[model samples]
Target: MSVAVDCSSEETADILVESQNSSLLENETEDIEEFFNVAMELAKNAGKVVRSAFSEKKNINTKLTGQDLVTETDQAVEKMLISSLKERFPTHSFIGEESVSAGKKCELTDNPTWIIDPIDGTNNFVHGNPCIAISIGLAVKKELLIGIVYNPIQERLYSAKKGQGAYCNNEEVTVSGQTELENALIYSEFGAHRDPEKLEIKFGNMYNIIMNGHGIRAQGSAALDMCGIACGEADAYVEYGIHVWDIAAGILIACEAGGIIMDPDTGGKVDLMSRRILCASSRSLANQLKNQVTPQSFPSD
Candidate 1:
């Protein structure tokens, strides 16, 4: 989490000076690029921390539920990330998973904020899997301006700025063109919420997807799953009990890659902190997945 960005205050001042131009949209774009550069720097540093910790003996513990585990690497990486970012952008708000797990509440406002998941797939990392990533996102004025998801183990980096195209390993990427659920590859990250009724609904959704979709992947990392969809590696993703820091970066990356982040309930807006998500390579596939697994059709609302 000690990624280095040699940007000085003078550069930031220059960016501010440029952002005060006549066109608001252009100014916003410049701001997004500026913050995106910072986020990418932090993400790369976090990736280094994660990779270094992968083979070491980590102190693991549970949170909220036994299924929800946290490692010392998670804590250390988050601390390093927040401290590094604070050194660069002292006024920016930070909402990190480790901080929230340590009893701090995270509330997003219309200010420049950084939402970070130091090690997105802690379980996978614990289990010696390489599907983990460092997720970092910047939101300005309540709008997501930059998204960065870096899988250090796989050496894959996915990033996007608002109104800019998404990229994977420096190459532009897009969502899969598959529009039908029957021909799509779907991924789901089941959180630690294991209520009986919810489990029933989740299993039902899995069954339907298994029967209809070409394949289904159960990954422990929501950010990497979203990157999969962004690069057309996976056609869709559906998960519940996810938090803002979990999918904030992924949402921007997916949307920029032509994927759809849909609300199963109203088929309208998808809130970043909604705790529910159904993403697809296309709107049609997203709607189709929503029809199959929306909670309203089951016991819970």
Candidate 2:
């Protein structure tokens, strides 16, 4: 006896569609993997520049204010990264802190763009502090895809890929899993803006955290602070007046490590250019921190 099987035309079309979708997904994965490898290598090379200048007396320059310092190492590293990345990805967009400060427009289009801070903790780097990071993040249509922050001095490397868990030194990491504010180890900074009025508001926010949390720590480096959240060293991090480059990589790494990010003001979705951030190990903690924060006004970055 012969058995006959009939397949409907619609079923065939559906199968074809599924296959096409799978192919597209595979291509996207491969593309991102390539981008990630390039980014990681660039971060290591940038670290070399930072390490070389760590012990040397540096040529320091002020950007917006005297406290907002930028060293020659910062410029050299940024130039090296931009030059190398442009060669590899000529069509992609770029936003570097030094470049933007030098008047390059900070625009995020739908194109793949690399957001970079050659040296995240410039003040710390200037003062011989090792809490600095070479931060690099890639975004497509404002969707973060990869984040890599390497603190060469401390030999700590934090990284993440979209939909993939965060890692520190090749080992997966996670948030501290503390929902209550009292149990949270909070990280914050006064930021580079020292306007007396702004400082007054910032201090008020700090006081709130100091009174409510287990402890408040100030690292002067937003990237490293966020990494602390990822690796369970800190439970919450809130800051205002930080540029997108400062937290671009850190944000993804923290979120990938089972963290939550929100706007400190409205507690809504984060706006990267808003110059504000609040992140925690859990949504409950994030909401608590959000309520405790009193944000100051600053022009969008």
Candidate 3:
């Protein structure tokens, strides 16, 4: 039965706005699907590059300090990722760790950008530690909407598209719902820096976690650490002196898997370029960690 009712102008306007919002959501979903499929392929291809070079001795070089290492595989994989993605998305922007190290500006704009960290755990990769990852994250209009982190050595692929939840190797996964600080397992990888001042701050934060939390482990790979939170293997992760590429992909996957992320210092929305991060299984747990952890800073990426 149809009712012949007169609608107010405000009601009509609300309907129009709702319709527009629905249309926008649908379009964004379509774009996400297209982008996700392409991203999946790129991650797999990048994985192949990493996998092929895993056991081979690499030409490793130190960056900034003797502790910060970069290998030939890192450069090759970065180039491969940029080239392939550029071929498919010429207009897209990029922020790659290797590229930035090579003199490119580490800038983020409103344009669609691909943040790539070809070998997130380069030190681990060099040590044949199987804890490395090919991390790719997409930010459009300065908001992260897609993330892909592939550990070719471990064959663990974690991914997410905004609103669709997170996955590991095609299986949906979630965070361990341990909200208490005493019960949480924490991941902190920050003692490698030679700067004694930074090391002191990093270690102090670690000390707090150790005293308060159930236990701690240093994964050496921030991307995988966040994925560990997403897959319920870990309860929390915190890092200072990490760049955008290190946590961008992992942030989305972890959040989609019912985890929470924030600035360890402020407990606010994390500034992707700020080089600080805290990820936890729940808001209560994250807030608890934020309260205990010592704050530290680094130059933005």
Candidate 4:
């Protein structure tokens, strides 16, 4: 269950190999192993807190809009995570969705930071659906380095470390190798809040997929949707109006699992904070999906 990768330069290969071999039996020197262990533990603990408050009557507040919600459990779990992480790494930055909503601008710093969504898919949680999850990710200088998404309902854990493969419940996972759109099952989200004209264009693109591809699904949870793609449960997922915390962890896992992600609007590599996303098993399918939806046709108004 432990892996050692040589990312050193040719000149340093001898030293790196010696270091690797020497540390093979040691515990503290392995950053990936340490990160995986801590993340998995913290996520499971947070999941326990979330589950405890799931069915009970708790204070829920709307933020940004009525559709966006936060519950007492979110704050409680975030506080729990922050306290635990701070205890372990006091100098590291921390950003949580609820913490930011409270006016804490925890910017990504050069120092290691933890980006957390204590309970993603809060709307689903409020409605008693079990699709919600706890998303925890570690980023260094704004680049995702480690990710862990835990669904307490299913007791499933999806995790990844940069340059190391992704895993679901300790089993290595990879995106489907489906290269053609016609053989791929895609997942997407469609809603009424978006511009009608823009929606029409997206719908048209989706219609093409429905007719030509294997099928389409809208799972309602962005984190789960990406994880589904990461584990090859689905071939691709595209959506808009999602924030960094919603997709940050899942995106890293998807990419580490061999999936490709791009901005749906520009067909460029996705910025982690970008609101729009198009994730697919292969570059060709992603481009095929992108070509079907033209940004020019989408109204700017």
RMSD of each: 8.0, 9.7, 8.3, 6.7
Measured by lDDT, the strongest candidate is 2
Tell me the tens digit of each residue's lDDT in model 4 across 222-255.
Answer: 8889899889999988876666777878987887
lDDT for each residue of candidate 1 in 81-193, tens digit (9 for 90 to 100):
88988998888998999998898878777678899998888888988899898999887655666889999999999998765778998999988867899998899866776
For each candidate in turn, the TM-score is: 0.88, 0.91, 0.91, 0.82
Q: In lDDT terms, how accurate is model 4?
A: 0.75
Ranking by lDDT: 2, 3, 1, 4
* Backbone atom clashes (below 3 Å) for every candidate: 0, 0, 0, 0
Stretches off by above 4 angstroms in model 4 are 1-29, 191-205, 294-301
Candidate 2: regions farther than 4 A off: 1-26
Q: Which candidate do you rate higher for lDDT, 2 or 4? A: 2
lDDT tens per residue, model 2, 1-301: 0000101222222212211222323457888999999999999988988998999999999989889999999999999998999999999999999999999999876688899999999999999999999999987756677899999999999999866789999999998889899988999997788799989888998899989989899998999999999999999999989989998899889877877777788776677888888878887898899888887778887
lDDT, candidate 2, residue 284? 85
- What's the true lDDT of residue 287 in model 2? 88
TM-score for model 1? 0.88
